[model samples]
Structures are given as structure tokens and as C-alpha cells.
Target: MFNEEFHLEQPIRWGMVGGGRGSQIGYIHRCSAQRDHLFQFVAGAFDVDAARGKEFGQNIGIAADRCYPDYKTMFAEEAKREDGIQAVSIATPNFTHYEILKAALEAGLHAVCEKPLCFTAEQAEELLALAKKNNRIVGVTYGYTGAQMIHQARRMIEEGMLGEIRIINMQFAHGYHSAAVEANDQGTKWRVNPKTAGPSYVLGDVGTHALFLAETMVPNLHIEKLLCSRQSFVKSRAPLEDNAIVLIQYDNGAIGNLWASCVNAGSTHQQKIRVVGEKASIEWWDEHPNQIVFAEQGKPVQILDRGQGYLYQDDEAITCDRMGGGHAEGLFEAWANLYRRFATAMDRVNHGEQASDVMNEMWFPNITDGAQGVRFIENCVRSADEGSVWVEYK
Candidate 1:
């Protein structure tokens, strides 16, 4: 169970770049950051249009003067303030992430960025270097890993309950884009455009989420090589795949497969991961995030629920459970959990403490994880473009 009393003496003043009106992701970021009273929404460059951005900021109770027209202006003007924003969340298009995040770090502000941190691994590394040099925290939103059950799985695996891990299957397939919906949707439009979405569509978009989940659960496995096949089911979105499959060979001799698609007809967010070990296996589905299916080699299957006494209560991850057993908790809570960690990290830096000092006590996806996701996309695209042949994981 989460401790409601956990909070900072003063909430971290925060701002945003993008995620204006009608942006679902923007709204989610706001709700999650402010949910635990760890962060306070102080300002934003909410939209590309200056006038509309200022209006949206004021409409959401932010002062008119604080809402700048662009991130550059926001960073400049905020720096002069005694109560300037200490952190900012980058919720803009994928292509803009690297620049905005770079600017924020240079301004000495911590950041919470949407994933695939940048287009290339080189860019991701640059941002990582800058963050370290500036002593700022860069949080990548791999939101699902914050779920209490995920921590339980991690604890179980670490305890040797799963024995020698053999196979890992992961996927984040949905049917929302079975057709050319981007023809009518602006949000979806940018995603299918290489200029805005980066190298591979589904591979970087949904695939990274699933990949991070597997990484969080089985922390010991490292990809040795991989083979990838991708397709642009919606013809208009050529050069940007709407579906992709990746086969990974782990350094430990464990094999893994990832299926990421936006064309899984009739499905609704079928994001799942199943890890098989010599003695048992455990599976988790985002649709039913509260429970995990556990099957031992010789016993009947068992369903482990969140907040149950049987869970690894000693694990720090399990401490994120916001509600007791029967009540439901979903993406919002998971995101909030990540945000809370981000805040703690930022707060530590603010007090002249290293964010890594408390790593064993708390864990959150940092810049290194973000860089790895970008590299994974790079590898997948490399293999796919080279006639879908096996390639070394760089």
C-alpha cells in the first residue's frame, strides 16, 4: 500500500512543452505529475500556436505571463524568476523530443520525456551526457513498469522462483489502426510521418513499452543479436511500419520475441508479456493489470492479485500499490507512480544529492534506459532494412 503521507515539503515547480488542449497524453502527464502533490503545474508552452498556447495555459489556471510561446522562451524567462520551474515534461511530437529535452537540461531543469528519447542512439547519448554534466534527472515514461504486480514479478524472478529463464514473449498489439485512420486524425498523422515519428513506427512507439516491461521483469538478460521484420499495413504510411516483429537472442542463451502492431484486428490494447523459466512461468496483461497468471511445471495455474499478502511486500516496487485488493487501478496510477519517483529524483538533485544514491531503495526509468530503447529501435530498423536478416545488437 502507498503511503499517502509521503510528500515533499515544497512541491517541485513544473512546466510543460506541448500537450495542449485535446491532447490525451498532455492531460495524462498533468494528472500524474500533480496526483501525489510532488509536482506543481506552474507553466507551459502548451501548443505550437502562441496565442492558443497562452490561452490554454490560463484556462487551466496558470498565470498568463508564465505561459510562453515556445520552449526556448519558457526556459529563458523562467530562469529569471525567483520561483522558476525546476523541471519540465516534454510531451510534444517524437522528433522534437531531443531538442526540447536538450534545452531543458541546459537550462538546469530536470525532465520527464515521452520515450524513444531521440531519433538515433547518438542523440540519446548526447542528452544522457548533458543530463549528467548538468546534474539533472531525465525520466522516460515507461509507465507500465510502475504497476505493483510488475514489481512482484521482479521480486519473484530475483528470488529464483522462476529458476533459469528460458523464453520471453512480449507484444503491444492493438487494432486501432487496422486501416488508414491517420488520413483523418492529426495525432495519428504525425505518428505515421517519418519526419515526426522517427525511424520505425510500431517498433519505437509500442514496442519499446513492451521491451522495457520485459527488461524490468528479467533484469539480467541482455540481447546478443536480433532479427526483425516490419510492414506498413496502411499503404500510405510507407517507410513507417505499422507492424513489426523482432526475434532476440539473449547473451545468456535465452531467446525472446516481440510483436508490436497497430493492426491486430479486433484487439484493444493487447499489451502482454510472458516469461518462461525451467520451473515455472508468469504472464501479465495490461488489460487486466491487477493480476498475474502463474503456472508452475507441475501445479495448477494461480492468479496473483495486487495488494495481496502473498506478494513480495518487502520489495520497494510493491510499495507503489495505491489501493487495497478489490479496488481497480490502471494506467493513471502507474504513471503517477513513475512521476512520484521522478519527483523524488529531482528533489534529491535539488538538495545537492546524487539521484543514484537511493537506487536500491527506489528505481525509475532513467536516461540510460531511454538511450537503450532508441538503440533497440535502431537495431530493429537496421535488420529490417537489410532484408530482415539477423544483426548484432549494437
Candidate 2:
């Protein structure tokens, strides 16, 4: 238990799993976790290959004795140490999320996991159950919602700046997998295999991010129904969809469409969102993440840029941190916000600080958010398989 201070004066001791020599997502998680110097990497399992994992541990300057061969061993042994990791970040493949997250929860450590959380709704539910049982914090890396512009957008909606949302438009596109790569690229091979990537590829990969973005931006946004169409542009390129479009109906009567694809040539990641309301409309593009355009029915378009509150103060922009207006902050910066929020919340809990009324007002993607992503994917797949019919998403 911590003293009355309960301050984050020092970095939180942390560990990693599955971010070895060439892990893409793992590297991003590591970068984000350390961005604010709020976390100290003290241990890790690192890889499935024992030798490679050990090498990574040593290269990263982790104490040899603290390194372990498998996540099971790492979690178990770390829990025994007085200076063990307070949190663990999992960067393994999609299929392994449930198992690794469960292990971390079981060992009584907070976790930050890469998105989609798990492959199935059942697995997601189990993780949530376990998280609750152990009183541990579980954060999913839905980094899009972490963007400062997004926070500003959400604040605007909450404040009725955009009166009565009528239409919500979003799109997520990627062209990295436009052509087959499994034959020559071992690193991306898992993305093309069902056994490794799970049932739905594009829908689960980028769709979840869009879904979370839509939900996060709107106040109490609820999907009433959905209609989806999916196609395997490259039959052998990936086990599941390479492209899809989902039409969503919100309970508030606002309608929207979400287009996601991995085979759109030249589209590295062009995720964009636009919300049209009775009084005004707001649009934000991932490519131009630092700014948001707002326009009322008879008003001129207003462009909002990012900046820290201390220097260039804009109430909405203050929610989003920035070195300055022109100094760009992208994926890693957004992820840093998620990691910081998770650490702060967990830090409070670990100090025997009980959950307060203020804590309930806190924001960060958690196990519940993870489960909702799974729900969005499963429902979309079902709607697509059943001939793109209207599937109730209640």
C-alpha cells in the first residue's frame, strides 16, 4: 500500500511480453509506454523463441535474472518480487491477447493490450470477468480516441456545440496488404492466416478502431442496427476480408457508414470522421490529425489546431497536448495519452486508494471497451455473411 502522497513522482515499474527483435506492434507499445518517462521497463518475456527473447531482454538493458522464457514464468516470478512490474503491456498477435491478458490479470498486474482485445466475444467476456475478479486495470490500445483533436471533438459534442447529431461518417483504409506478402515476409505472415489473425481480418484490424472512434466521439452513441458487405479482394492474401462497408443506425436516429479496407492502393491509413448535426458539422482526418474543421449551417468553416494549454490556450485544444501548433504528433503521441491515463488510474488503485466519484468520470479504453470492439466485429461479420441484411445491434 502506498502512503498518503499516492503521487506519480517516480516512473511506474513495467514489463513487456512479445516485443522481441522484430515485433512491429510491440515496438509501438514500448515507445508509447515510455514517451512520458512515466514507466520504467524492468522486465519482459519478449518472444516465443527463448534465445531471441533473452537477447532482446539483454539488449534493452533488463536485468538478466528478471527476464523469463515465457509469459507464464515472467508473470509468476514477477509477482513474487517486491519491485515487480505494476503493469504489463501485451503486444502479441491477435489470437494470443486473451491468454496473455488473462495471465497478467491472474497475477494481479494491470495490463495494456493491443486492440480487438480477443478473437471471440466469449474470450473478451472472460477477460473482463477476470479483470473484475482480480481488481486489475485492463487497457486496450485504441489510440485513435487518444488524439488531442478527438478529445476536442468529443468535448464539443458533449457541450452541445454540435446540436443533435444527424449523420456520422467514418472510413479506415490501408494499402499495405494490397498484394500478397506471406511468401516472402515472415513478419506479416500471421496477418494472412486465420489460425493466427482470427476469423475477420480487415473488419477486426481497422474496423474496430473506426467503431471505437464513432462511439467515442458521440455522446451515448448506440448502434440500433447495421448492414454490411464484405469481399475477399485477394482470396489468398488474407483468411478474411480485405475490404468492407458497414451502414450503422444509431438509437438516436443518426445514420452513418464505416468503410474499412486493407487493399486500397496508396492508402497507407486514411481514417476520417465527420459528424453532421442540426446546428453544425465537424470533420477530422487522420492524415491531417492536428486539425479539425467545423462549420455551422450559415457560418464559415473554422479550423481548430492542437497546442498545450500552458502556451496556446484554446479550451477545446487544451484537452489535446502539443509542443506547438506545427510540431506534429501522431500515433505514438496518442498512445502516450492512453498509457498515461491507464498508469494514473492503476497507480491510484495500487495505493489502496479506493475508487472515488471522480474516478468514475475518468476516461480511458478498458476491458469494457475491448468487449465492445469484439461485439462490433462479430455483429458486422454476421451481417455480412447473412447477405448484408439489417442485423440488429442492440
Candidate 3:
């Protein structure tokens, strides 16, 4: 069970670079970071419009002076303060991520950044190197991996319950943008624009989330090669796909497929993953995140509910259960879990402990994972653009 009383001696002073007014992503970031009283939201460059950004920041209880006109200004000004921000969250569009994150790290601040960490794998590598040199924590919000059931799956797989994992299927297909909604929606507009959203749309947007889930569950598998085919179903979003399929060959001889689409008409966030092994298989759906379907060969299927005794008793998994079985805990809890880990990581680093050392004690999606996601996007795009031929994974 999660301990509500758990807190750092002094909450990490946190700020934001985006996720201003009317931004659902911003709200989630704030809620999750402050949920367990682990972070203190003290500043932000909330929007492109300085006036509106300041207004929004003030409305949310931030001091007007702390909400600067832009991220650079915010970082520069905050550094002179006696109580400067030690960490920041970048909630901006895809293109701004690399620059803002770079600035944050150079400013000696820990960061929690949105996915598709940068436009290219090269950029991701640079960020990784910069993070290491600065000894800063770069937490990528692969939010779903923080779910308790995910850890449960990891434990089960580690225990060889899913013997010799062979096949993995992952998808995060949804129907929200089936008909070119970006025509009027600002949020959707930036996402489809290659300048703002990066190389592939659905691939980096939702595909990485599913990929990370599989990675978390079966940590030993490594992609050796992959073939990808992508389409911009709503023609106008050209060069940036609205749907994509990736077929992967793992070094361990495991085969996997990923389907990421926003055109799965009539579907509502159909994010799911199914892992098959020689002995049995396990499946999880985000819609019903609290349960896992366990099917052993030649036996009746079983449903593994969260927080149950039958589940693994590992400290990481058990402690993630915010509420006992029979209660509901969704994405908010999941994001908060990651935030808690991020705070701990930042705190440890601040106290002269190494980031790698902290990781050895607790798991959180860090810079390395973010770099891998970016590399995955790069590989998928490369394969798709070249007539969808099988390409050796770099």
C-alpha cells in the first residue's frame, strides 16, 4: 500500500516550461507531482503568450514574479534566487523538448519531460551525454509503466511464470482523430505538423508507451531488427503518420508487433499488451488496468487482480498498490507513482548520491529509456520511409 505520509525532508522546488492553461497534460503533471507532497510548484513559463502564462500561473497560486516570459528567462532569473527551482517539467510540444530540456540540464535542474524526447536519435544521444556530464536526472514520463500491475507482470516474468517468452503483441490504437480533427483543434494541429510533432505521429505519440510496457515486463529482450509500415489515414497529416505497424525481431528469438493508430474508429483508448511464452501467457489492457489476464496452457484462465496475496510480493510492486484490491486506481495514481520515484531520484542526487546508484535502489523511466524511445522512433521511420523493408536495428 502507498504511504500517504511519505515525503522528502524538503520537497523539491519544481517548475514547468509548458502545460499552461487548457492543457490537460499540464494538469496531470501538477497533480501527480504534488499528489504526495514530494514537489513544490514554485514557478513556470506556462504558455507562449507571456500575459496569459503569467495569469494562469498566478491563478494556480504561483507568484507572479516566478512565472517568467519564457523558459530561458525563467531559468536565468530563478538561478539568482535564494530558493531557486531544483527541478522542472517540460510539458511543451515535441520540437521544444530538446532545447528546453537541454537548457534545464545546463541550468543544473532535474527534468521530467514528455515523450519523443527529441527529434532525432542523435539529439537524444546528445541529451543523454549532457545529462551524464551534469549528473542530472532526466525522467521521461512513460506514465503507464508506473502502474502496479505492470510491476506484477515484471515479477511474474522474472520468476519464469511465463516460460521462455516467445511472442509479444502491443497496441495503443484509438479513434479520437479518425477524421482530421486537427483542422480545428490546436492540440491536434501541432501533433500532425512534422515541425512540431517529430518524425512519426502515432509511432512516437502512443507507440512508445506500449513499447515501454513490454520493455518493463520483459527486460531481457533486445530488438535486433524491425520492419515498419505507416500511413497517414487523414491524408493532410502527410509525412507524419496517423497510424503505423512495426514488426520486431528480438535478439532472444522473440517476435513482437506493435500497432499504433489514432484511426481505430469507434475505439476508446484500446491500449493493450499480450505476452506469450512456452508455458503460458499474460495480457493487460489499460482500460481495465487493475487486473491481468493469466492463461496457463490447458487450464482455465485466471484473472490476477491488483494488490492480491496471490500476486508477487516484491517491495516495488506491493508498495505501488495505492489501494487494496477491489478499489480503483487509474492513470493519476500511476503518474503519481512515477513522480514519487522522480522526487526520490532528484533528492538522492541532491544529497551527493549518484543517479545510477539511486536507480539501483528504485526503478523509474530515466534518460536511457527516453533515448531508447527516440531511437525506436528513428528506426521505425527509417524502415517505413524505405518501402517498409526490414532494417537492422541501430
Candidate 4:
């Protein structure tokens, strides 16, 4: 059991390994961490170029001495300080996750890293075991799972409010790469490059978020078999797939379909998931994140709004904002919620305690969830490469 009396006297000190100037994802990570008021950025290694890294750090108000040229130096020097960072955020590209994460854990610092834990399932599993050995908290940020309504859906499914889940339909579509930005833009070039983004670029980048959301909401279902097809619309601009589709069979006898496309001209940053059950069904979309369209077998569809008063499940209300009801709190708030919750758990672990059942179920996205995501990416690629032959999900 964890101590309720444990006091967090100060905001946890945190550092960053990436997200220097002109990096959109880096800005998002920094803003989200600050929004929660649970973390204070103290140090950083912001870019691959040492001069650029120092300049970026200085501009962001990180002291000249603490601004490091590389992640290795940041972790080492910070670990030596008495008031060193307790946690570090890895906002770098997909391929850099493994070494940075391992460094943080080995240095006795907690981590809140971006999704798709690593390039391979073996690396993901190794990182998970290392975190356990060090007794540290490792959080993978699945931003969409931070949404309040998503939690409500998870609770409803767990409580059997929606009978037995029968089908799942998920899609994440974007228009940014519809015309191939990689051909001209150097910043986004890594996304289409196998060396930086790993195999299955579309799936590994944005598609994995959809996979994690389904895994989080439908906890009882395990993927049994998968058949996938991946396509590259402009082969000259990008070698990796920009569009992909997947068909999944679950161990619990449910079926699922997933589609991811970067070439959808109008669907910019749109993501949605629909889970159907024997008695009722629920659907949610990021575009209109404040509501859930729920339907019963014979009853009319109910437009469920997110607020403390509108929730039947108490756990959902706990995630609601102080001044909610009509005011929209979307992406940044949701992401911050994940950070705050992760920090809370890290605080517990540092104080010599165990995370309660509620924390694991409702708050944290632990190592196991991240490992499964890596496995999903690996399995999906294998299935596609084998001529869409059904492959058993390991």
C-alpha cells in the first residue's frame, strides 16, 4: 500500500533531451508538461548539434551550465547534482527513444517518453525489464488516452455497461503529408526515412496511437491475428508507407479494423474510435472530443457531454476540469493530465511505496502497454510484407 501522507513539497524538476527550436512536437511536449504545474524544466540537451543545443537551451532559460550538448552528458551531470532533475522527457524522433530511455532509468531518473517505445519489440521488452530492475517509473505518453471521455468509456466497458464488446473500428487520418512534404522539407524527412522512423512509418508514427487507444479502452481483448496492407502514395518522395489498413481478430472472439492515412487531403489530425457491444455501442472522435455518441439496441443515440455532472461513473468526474461543463479543454490539458498523473506515481515510488490499483487502471501508461504497442507495429509490418497473410500477434 502507498502512503497517503507523503508530501510532495516542491514541483518535480525535469529535463528534456529534444524539442529545440522549430520543432513542433518538442513545443507540444514542453507546453503539456508545464500546463500541469507538477513539473519545472531545469535542464536540456535540445539538438544534435552541440552549438545549436546550447543556444536552444539558453533561449529557453535553461542555465548555460546545465544546458548540455548531448543526452549522455545531461543524464550524467544531472545525476551528480543534489537538486538534479527527477524526471526527463524524451521528445526526440522514434529511433532515439531506446538509448535515451535506458540512460534515464540507469541514472535513477524517471521518464515520460513519446509513444512507440522503440523500433523493435525486443528493445521495448528490455527497457521494461530495466525499469523494474532500477525501481523507476517509466511512462509512455499516449496523448489520446488522456481525454476524460476515454476514461469514462474504459470504466463503462470494464463494468459491463456495454455488454460484450463485439467490434472495433479505429482510424487516424492526416492531410499534412498528402502532397509529400518530405521531398522538400528536411525537418520532416526523418519520418519517411527507415533509418530514423523505423519500418512502417505511417503505422509507427500516428497509427500506433489508435492501436494504444483500443488496447486501453478494450482491456479484455487481446489481438490474436492481424492482416495488414501498407501503401506509399508517392514513392519518389518517401520510401515508407503513408497509408495503411489493418484487420484484426481478437482472442475473445471480437473483430477490428484500423485505417491510417497521411494522404487524406481534408482530414487533418483527425482520429476516431468506435467500439460496439452486444447491448450498446459508443463512438468518440478527437475533432469533437467533448462528446461521446452512445446508442442502445432500441433507444435513440445519446450525445454524451463531458463534465462532472454529466458522468454516471465517479472516476470520469475525477478527470473533469475545475471550470468545465461548456468550456472546451482539449489536447494540451489531456496531455498535461498524463504528466501530472505520472509525476504523482513517481512521487510515490520515490517515497518507497507501491502504486495502487486505481493509479494503474486510470492514470499511468506503463512499460507493458508501451511494449505491446511496439509489438503491434512489428506484427503489422510482418503481416503486410507477407502479402497480407494473417499473422499471429506475438
Candidate 5:
């Protein structure tokens, strides 16, 4: 058994590879890590650009001495410290994930990287092996998995409260289309650049969240085949696809549809998920993230709050119930919660102690999920390129 005593004294020391000034995702990652207070960021190489790296460090209150100019500097300097960073959060763009992550793991540091995991499946495989060989922990942030109420929804389904699941209808669309891809100069910059963004456009970014949610709630779920279509509605945008639609089938005969577009107007993150089961149906959405709407046959609709007195079979479900109702928790908090879990896992592994419930449930996304996500993006692009024929997932 792991010693609770050991876990308490040693907090996870952390650093950052990206997420410099004005970076949306990096800000989210920092807020999330701070929320739990389980991980203490001791150092960072916040930006790939030197000036921005220093300025970002100053802006975030990260000390100059600990804020290095590049990831290489951060790794080399910190690894020499007796109090070096135990982990590094990679908030860089998609393409940078693999190399930065590989270095971190090799240096005996754990990693909490933002998603789409890696740019390719092969990189994902190699990283997984490196992590195993080093006995290091890695987590990919699939935001929906950490959302408070999503846990309750997953638990209800797992406990058979919703009966055998049949189909999932998940739709997430936003009006950021033009704002994201057309905000020329700096607007459509890195995100639309193929060199930085790696592959598809809006779908690779937001669509992954939709896929992670569906995959998490359903049991024995393996994405069997997928049919996808892409669109460059703006036509002349550089770097990535601006819009896309994907059809997915799970191994157990369940089907799902996902659509993402950056050209669509007047939409403000309109997202919802509906799961139809033999016993009942449940619905949840980002707009009303606080509750999951559960409806059973011939019964009034029920709204379940976070952290209420509910029995949830999954660790994530229990996490939701513990947080309770009326306390609004969103993206940043969920991200923080994942970091807290990462701290727990790191403490277990670093101290050479036995694992706990958090480790057992594998609450955070790992190497396989990362690999799967890369394949997912590749297939989506391939299907779109090949005239939208269904593509098989390897």
C-alpha cells in the first residue's frame, strides 16, 4: 500500500514548455494547475521565442531565474536542481508535443500535455514506450472528461441506470469560425498554419472534445469505422481546414455524428450530447454544464447536479458527486482537477509506492488515447481527401 504520509510531504514540482503570454490554452492550463494547489510550478520555458518567454515569465510571476528562454534550457537547468521540476506541462502547438514530451520523459519528468496528444500515431507509440521505460506519468487533457457533471452522466450509464446504451448524438458548433480562421495578421496565424497546427482545422481542435466525451461514457466502445468530410469554406485560408463533419461507428453497433465548422455564423459554442439507452436517455451541454438531464420512460425529466448525494460507479462520477450542486465548475477547474490527479499518480510512482484509486481508474488520458487521437485526425483528413468514404481506424 502507498503511504499517505509520503504523498503529503512531497508536492509535484512542475514547469511549462509553452503557454506563453496571451496564449489561450496556456492560460487555461496554468489556472487549472493553480486551482488544485497540488502541483507547484517551479520553472518554465513559457514561449518558443526568447523575448516572449521572458516577458511571459514576468507576466505570470514566474521568477526570472527559473524562467529559461527555451525548453532545452529549462530541461538542462532544472534537471540539475535537487528541487527540479517533477513534471512539465506542454502547452505548445500540436506539432511540438512529441519532441518536448520525449525530452521531458527522458529527463525523468512527468508530462501533462494538451490534446490531440501528438501529431502522429507513430510518435504516440514511441512516447508511450518511453514513458513505460522511465516509469513516468503522462496525461492528455481531453477537457470534457474533467468537467464535473460529465462524470455523473458517465457513472449513471456505467451503473446500468441508463440500461444498455444504444446510440449517442453529440453536436458542438461555435461561431468562432471566421474569428478563428480569418482574424488575419495574428488572427489566422499559428492555428491556421499547417506547420504549426499540423493537420485539419476546426475539427482537430474542438471535434476531439466531442469524441472524447462519447468514448468515455460508453462501455466496450471502440471506434470501428469513421466517415469524414472537410471544407475550406473560406477557400484561401492557409495552414488548416476551416470546417469538417465526421460520422463514427463504435464496435458495439452504436453510431455517432460530429460536426465542426469555423465559417458558420451566430453560433456561440452550441454544444450538446444525447445518449439513448434501452432504459433511458440522458443529455448534457456546455451551455448548461452544471446539470445532466436524465429522462426515463414515462417519467418526468430529472436534472442531476454536481456533487449531490448520488452513487457513481466511476471515480470521475464520485468526483462530481463530491463537488455537489450550485458550485459552478468549468474548464479551468476541470483542468486543475486533472493536474491534482496527476500529482497523486506521480507521488505514487516517484516514491515507489503502490497505486491508489486515481491511478487504477486511469482518470486522465494516456499514451493510447494520444495515439488514437492522432489516428483519428489522420483518418478524418484521409476520408475527406478520398471523397468521404468510411475509413477504418487502426
Candidate 6:
């Protein structure tokens, strides 16, 4: 049991599963978990292959005695230790999230799993059930939620600055599948596989991030109906569609457009979002993630940067700021902030600290976000499969 003072004063014990040498997302998670000084990687099974796992663990400075051969061994032995990981970071492929998270939860450890949550809606639901059954925390690292600017955007909308939100436009595009790589590049291979990554190519990959931001910020917006079209421009490049366009209708009579593609040339993660409302409008781009653009009648357009003091100070958003104003915080730090916030909350619970009435009001993305993300993917696929019919989400 750890108190708030004890928690921040001492690092939380943490472990990693997967993210061996050259694994793309694995490095990001590891870097993020280490950035805030809130977490310490006490153990890990960094690869599917035993030798590779040990090698990767050593490369990352994990002790050999603590780097076990498999997640099972790592979980079993760590549970016996008096000082074990308080949480585990799952950086494995999309398909492995459920199994790895289930194991961690069963071991009485909280989890920070990378996104898409599960390969299927059913699997995602089961994982949600398991988390409750084990009384463990499961947070999918939707890194954008950690951005200071995003918190500001959500605040502006929720505080009625954006009265009667009307529209959301979002796009996520990258030029990865077109680039040449190994025939079976472990990094690229699994992402393209349907069984592993689930439906709709870039939809689940970067699309989830876009959906998370728009839905989180816009008020009274729901995906009432969706019409989608998908394409695989690169000849059998990835089993999933390389490009997709989706049209959505919100329950509050608002509408949205989503465009995602992996085949787009010269676009290096050009993720952008725009929200329009009666009182104001806001826009954000992932390439310039630290800043948001705000426009409203009778006011000069404002550019809000992450980690800088906002026009309106929000403690939840402010706590995520690392350096002084003008210094930029990147994607990795955003992820770290989420973990730090989760640790702060869990530490309060561990020490018998009465939970804050507004803990749920904080910016961290929870299980509901996970469920909605999966639902969004499902809706996109259903629309595309049914000859681009406008399918209702519910």
C-alpha cells in the first residue's frame, strides 16, 4: 500500500511484456513509462522467442534474474515477491492485448495496454469483463488524451465555450505500407494481418486516435449512422485496406467525416481534427501535436500549446506539463503522463485515500473509450462491407 507522498516520492514497480529489439511501439511505451519517473521496469519478457527475450531485456538494462522467459513465468514469480510490479505495460501486437492483460490482471497487477484494445468487439468485451472480475485497472494508452492541448479542447467544449457542437472532421494518413521492407517485417507484418490487427487497415491503427480526440472533445456527438468505402491501392501490400473514407451522423444532428489511409505518399502521420460549434471552433494536428487552434466570432484566433500555462488554468491539464512554457512535450511524454496520472490515482486507492469525487472527471482514457473505439472500427467495416450503406452504430 502506498500513499500519495510515498507514491511520488518512490517509483512505482513496473514490468514490460514484449517490445523486443526493433519492435516499434514497444520502444515508445518503454520510453513513455520511464519519462515521468513514476514507473520502474523491474521485470519483462521482451520477446516471443526465449533467447531473443533475454537479449532484449539485457539491452534495455533489465536484470537477467528478473527477465523471465515468458509472461507466465514473469507473472508467477513476480506475484511471489514482496516488492513486485504494481502494473504491467503490454506492448505486444494488437492481438495479444487481451491475453497479456488477462494474465497481468490475474496476477493482481494493473495494466497499461497499447490500443485497439482487442482484435474484435467480442474480445474487447471479454477483456472488459475480466478486468472487473479481477478488480484490476486496465488503461489503453490513447496517447492523444495525455496532450495538454487536448485537455484544453475538452475543457472548452465541456465548459460550454463551444455551445451546441455541430461538426467534427478528422483524418489520419501515413506513407508506411508503400515503403519497402522485409517480406515479413515483424513490425509491418502483424499490423497488416487481419487476424492480428482486426478490421479496416489504418482505421484501427491511427483512426482510433482520431475518434478518441473528436468524441472526447465534442459534446452530444454520437455515431448514429456511418457510410464507408475502403480500398487496397497497394497490390496485396497489407491484408487490410490501405485507404478508407467514412461519413458519420451524430445523434445531436451533428455530422462527421473520417479519412484514413496508409497508401498516401509523402504524408508522415498527417493526423488532423476540426470541431465546429455555435460559439467556437477548434483544430489540432498530430504532426504539430503540442498546439491547438481556436477560432470564434469577435475574437482573434488563439493557438494553445501543450505544457504552457493556459488562458484558463486546469489543474488536471497543468499537472501533465513537464517543462516550463515554450518547451515542447512529444508523443512519448504524453504517454508517460497518462501512466503517471493512473499511478497517482491507484496510489491513492492503495493507501486507503478517499477517492476524489472528480477522479472520473480527469483526462485519462478509460474502458468506455476502449469500447467506443472498437465500435467505431466495427461500424466502418460494416459500412464498407454492405456496399457502403449508412449503418447505424446502435
For residue 318, give model 3's deviation from the true position in Å: 3.4
**Candidate 3 lDDT by residue in tens digits, 1-394:** 7777878999999999999997859999999999999999999999999999999999999998998999999999999998999999999999999999999999999999999789898899899899888999989999998888888888888889989999999999999999989888998899999999988899999999999999999989999999999999899999899999999999999999999999999999999999999999999999998989989999999998988887767566545677778898899999999999999999999999887777667789999999999999999999999999999999
TM-score-best of 1 and 6: 1
Q: Could you tally the backbone clashes for each prediction?
A: 0, 0, 0, 0, 7, 0
**Highest lDDT against the true fold, candidate:** 3
lDDT of 1 at 312: 77
Between 1 and 5, whose lDDT is larger?
1
Clashes of 2: 0
Runs in model 3 lying further than 4 Å from the true structure: none
Model 2: lDDT to the true structure = 0.81
Instruction: Write model 4 residue lDDT over 221-326, tens digit each, in one string.
Output: 9999999999989785445789999999999899999998888898767789999999999898988877788888899889877775656545732354634567
Task: Give the Cα lDDT of each candidate.
Answer: 0.92, 0.81, 0.93, 0.82, 0.76, 0.77
Model 5 quality (TM-score): 0.91
Candidate 5 lDDT, 276-335, residue by residue in tens: 988899998887777789999999999887766563534543453224467676766666
Higher-lDDT candidate among 2 and 6?
2
What are the per-model C-alpha RMSD values against the true structure? 1.0, 3.5, 0.9, 2.9, 3.2, 3.2
Using TM-score as the measure, name the better of candidate 2 and candidate 4: 4
Count of clashes in candidate 1? 0
Model 3, TM vs. native: 0.99
Q: Please, what are the lDDT tens digits per residue for candidate 2 over residues 286-388?
A: 8888888889888888888776343233342245453556788788878877787878877777777543321465778888888988888889889988998
Q: Which candidate model has the greater TM-score, 1 or 5?
A: 1
**lDDT score of model 5?**
0.76
Residue-wise lDDT of candidate 6 within 1-394, one digit each (tens)? 0122324756778998888888887888888777667788789988888888897798779988888898999999988898877888888888887788877877878778887777667877887777666556667788876777776787788888868888899988888666544265878777777887777568888888888889767735777788988887765644478788989888888989888887778888888899988888999987787788999968999888765544456355644456666777778767777877767655654565433322454546766578778878887888888898888785
Ranking by lDDT: 3, 1, 4, 2, 6, 5
